[model samples]
Target: MSTFKAPKGTYDLIPPVSETFLAVREALAAPLRRAGYGYVETPGFESVELFARGVGESTDIVTKEMYAFTTKGGDELALRPEGTASVLRAALEANLHKAGNLPVKLWYSGSYYRYERPQKGRYRHFSQVGAEAIGAEDPALDAELIILAVDAYKSLGLRTFRLLLNSLGDKECRPVYRAALQDFLRGLDLDDDTRRRIDINPLRVLDDKREAVQKQLTGAPMMRDHLCEACKTYHEQVRELLTAAGVEFEDDPKLVRGLDYYTRTTFEFVHDGLGSQSAVGGGGRYDGLSEMIGGPELPSVGWALGVDRTVLALEAEGVELHVPASTQVFTVALGEEARRTLFGVVTELRRAGVPTDFAFGGKGLKNAMKSANRSGARYAIVAGERDLAEGGVQLKDLQSGEQAPVALGEIVAELRRKLV
Candidate 1:
């Protein structure tokens, strides 16, 4: 046996399974593209401070899960644990916000790293499909992002996931709400770590999944009740837009997302059937993220859906993503003379936009046809020494089990006319 593997907490995506991943990415990004979001690609790793500031130092992403290391140049860098921060950093560095576009719309598909205890849907390394609309504070943008996500899921035939919505309130009201939350948290019997969370980011305490912490938090102060007038209006407008658009959502006061930068609007998508790791994806408005990362004050909203988790959710609901079959034609040749001649014809067929494949081994005609059948090819092109000598070949329709002898010079046009 080989002494190497894909490393713990990480899995290889191969073949048919990879097709599912591609399908999910396409389903999610298709709507974003239509909505004016151009594709963006950022490096897999960035300076550690980018996330520390953009994602919030107090959050588990930075404090615990991030895979950070000092490079040979003494620069601290981390593989992105999430997509939004790096995308935001790229936007900031490129002066995308200053490009006069009110919202620099972009979509990305990539992998993320986190030192998590490996589980069904959670991994030390995972893939994500995220979208960001930067430089905007409009409630419609918030609602639009959410609607895009919902549409993406629906288009993928997913039905088991539920949308969770919340507002953390803007800067004007969040401080007051944090103070109230702190007062309540301090009174609870919490561990040292929980207490530290109170000082660094009291809102994160609301994200505690422990039974005891959740019980103690049942009567805690709610941020929604303390929202400032402006935040309340913004949140309300977001809700109104979603409602008017007929997007279903549940208002969750406890959805104070784990990230520290999220302000005003926070949301999560959960699959009820996924057991403990039910959150398939989520994101929110991070109005202070730019300033936190030492950039100008630019508000941004976005979401990252777990491609793995989404695939699991689809599986849980028995939703099969229909990945189209690999190609239309398979070419089979017998003897060296025929093989050489057919190889050129195969190349020409492919160049002419035909999805074609050819047998590699010098197999007998029967075995070649068998290979063609296994390849899911709709048609098979067979050429033997005799056919090569006669200036023609045979075309067989695998579906109809019918064959026709055609002139060699006319095969390409015949295939094109029949296949198209």
Candidate 2:
């Protein structure tokens, strides 16, 4: 092993297992693609202020978990701890919303960084597939995103996960709820740090998971109770739409999420089997985020499904993803001349859209066949000097142990036929 390892809270995605992660990401993004959401990519790091202001400075993600640093140029930068803020910043900077589109739909898949005490289902470096609908505030837009997420999870055969939903009243009524929540939180026996959170963002204090904190928060005011008539109607419409579409969700009164940007509709996808870190993915509306980062007012809604956590959820439910074999056909060449000829054949097979691999380093037939077996390929082509002289190559079906021969020029066509 090399003397170095992936940084303490990070991981390497190796084969077999890595294939599952890829499948999970593709599954999550498929619905977004079909929904007219274009792909978006952002830098791994951005100005620290973008997050401090957009993600809410009082949130743990900004103050404690953010991987922030001051560059040699005296510029402060931080590896993104989440996707929403960075994505919105990019959309605003590029003026995508001004392109005559009411909601610029975009989807993204990448790794996000955070500084946290890593544990099962929680890591400093993790993968996520996110979607954002910028410049819209309709409840149907929120319902649409939720439906798309549910479809993605269902497409992966995940059934035990639950969608927990809540509405964190928008600017009109959030202030009223915030004050009420802060008043209730202050009466609890909280630490100095948590007490300070009461002043900055008391909703975050309600997200506290500590047993001592939980015990004291029994009577805390819920956002549902404080929602204004507009927010209440909007929340009800979202719920009604989700139900009409057959997406079942439990109404969570205190689902504030970890970020401070979330306003109005907040939700989380949780798998009961995931233990303490049950949230596989979640996101919600951030109506004021655009203005928070010095952009025009653009109400947006989005969700990011955790690729790592989704894989864990799959395993927890004992669901097997149908990851296709990387190599569909393996070629074993005997002699140097046979290697050259078979190498050309391999290239031809690949050009013909066959997933083919060749045995390199000139191993003996036995070792080469062993490699072919381990490749998970359905078929193997073996060519020796004698076989090449005869103008044919031996073809073996790895699954049934059937062997035959096909003309050298016809091998690619033969494999393609059998594969189909």
Candidate 3:
């Protein structure tokens, strides 16, 4: 025998559990769809320069985690590490900014890749449901994205999550803070890699999770303290709007986010039950992202909800999603004549919007009945040579053990009425 297995970082989603994943994705996108967010689809991979320019040169996503490769055409491309950059690039390519709408809203759901050590809530490949509202920089737009994200989680019955909010000042005041922060970080004892980061992007030093770095960062200059008047008012208005919308959030000064393009308001929905990797979904305002990637200066706010992590959160909180079974009607036929007739009946039933399946391989009465019972179908259509000759079919209620005979022509209507 040959030894074969799935890739180390990926798992095939199969059966009853896969239904739950689909349900979760739909639930997360429902509110966005209701709020005029049109669906947007993007390729799994994009130009390496798109991420390198948009995500930031010093961030782990581009510098270390991205899955970059040179194609046969000598093009440098990579499997998208996140959603916002690609979404912005797509909107730019399509020239959605020229459509005259202030904010072109869009929703997307797909897989994202990152070369991280696989753990409980982190994986090399994971699914995400994301939404973006571009071409607007108003605080209300920021609040709208946050509200939609909150509604998505609540719609999924996720209660044990908290929203962490912050503001990374935009062009007006960020330079001053960056300079002061760089001066502070330079005095500390850091390794060569971190020291190099201090020059490329000093804000990343704030996101470092190492206990040693965090210990020295206790006195680091905070963005909230140095926010310019416009940024301060923008962050305050976002807070006020979120509160008016009845969305509770905690002010987290350390929440600088992991991206370079993020400016003004930033937030994250974290589930404490997930231990170290707690973020279930998060996004913020990217006021300069479009121009950073060579597009016009279009601002956007969005978030990507982690399907795998959200499922883990549900399990952690003992929540089970209500997903319907695959088959609603199971057909059992004996003999060649009955098989031919019932096959047509099954096809008609499916065409009428009934989820129906049939027993194949000519199984006998006892075995076919067992298979029908195991299918989780509400009713079983049982027919044999005797019933076929009589122009009738036996519709058996699998749960009640009751049987009734109906005219062959009336079977589809009967099942549809009962199933409905």
Candidate 4:
């Protein structure tokens, strides 16, 4: 082992495990693609003020968790702690909302960075597959995002996860509820940080998970009670649409996600199996976020499913994803001439859309065959000087231990036929 390692609270996705991560990402993005969401990519870092203004100054993600730094050029930047703020900034900068679409749907997959004490389901650096529908305030858009998340999880064969839904109410009614919640929080015994949060973002105080804080919040005010007529109707429509689509969700009155931008409809996906970090992924409406970040009013609803947590959920429930073998065929060349010839064969097979690998480093027949066997390849192509002299190669079925001779020209076609 080298003296160096991945930075504390970070990890490298390598080998067989990395394959599962890719599969999980694909599963999460599939629903978005089917729903007309186009792919989008953004830089790993952005202006620190972008997140400070968009993610909110009072949130822990901004106040403590964000990995912020100043560059040599005197630019303040931070590795993105979340997806929505960065994505929205990119969309607005590129004028995507002006492209004659009511809701500019986009899907993205990438890593996010934060400074945090790492845990099983939580990491300082993690991967997420997120979808956003910008410039739309419709309930169907909110419901559509939730349903898409549900479909993605189910697609990965996850059954035990539950969707916790809530409506934080819009600007018209949130202040009234905020004042009520703040008053209730003031009467409770709490730490300085918790007390300060009551004033800055009182709703987040209700989200506190500490046993002491949670006990004091027993009868705290709920957003559902303070929602105005418009918000109530909108929330009801979202719930009704979800129910109509056969998606079951529990009404979580306190599901104020750990973000300040969310408004009206809010939700979280949780798996009880992930103790202490039960939330797998979640997001909600952020209607005023655009204005907060110096852009026009573009109400948006989105969710990011954590790839790391989803993989953990799968392991907890023992749901193994179906990842096909990476190498379908492994080739073993016996001699120098055989090496050049078989290398050509490997290239040909790969160009023909066959997953092929060649035994390198000039290993002898026995060692090369061992490498081929370890490759998990279904078939092994063995060619020696004698076999080449016969203008053919030996194709051995790795599974059945059967060998047959095939003409050099027909090898690609024969393998494709066998694979099919």
* Residue pairs with clashing backbones, model 1: none
lDDT of 3 by residue, 283-382 (tens): 8989899999998888889888999999999999999998887899999998889999999999999999999999988899899989988888999999
Candidate 3 clashing pairs, residues 3+ apart or interchain: none
Q: Write the per-residue lDDT of candidate 1 for residues 1-420, one digit (tens) a residue.
A: 988999899999998799899999899888999999989999999999998887888889899999999999999999998888888889888998888768999999998999989988989999989999998889999999999999999999998788999999887888888899999999999999999999999988888999989999878999889998898899999999999999889999999777888888999999998999999999999988888888888888999988999999999999888887677889999889888999999999999999889998788878888889998888999989998889999999999999999999999999999976
Structure candidate 2, residue pairs in collision: none
lDDT score of residue 132 within candidate 3? 92
Candidate 4 CA-lDDT value: 0.94
Instruction: Give the deviation of candidate 1 from the true structure as CA RMSD.
Output: 1.4
What TM-score number comes out for model 4? 0.99
Which one wins on lDDT?
Answer: 4
Error of 3 at 310 (Å): 0.6
lDDT of each: 0.91, 0.93, 0.92, 0.94
Candidate 4 or 3, higher TM-score: 4
TM-score for each of the candidates: 0.97, 0.99, 0.97, 0.99
What is the descending lDDT order? 4, 2, 3, 1
Clashes of each: 0, 0, 0, 0
Error of 4 at 335 (Å): 0.8
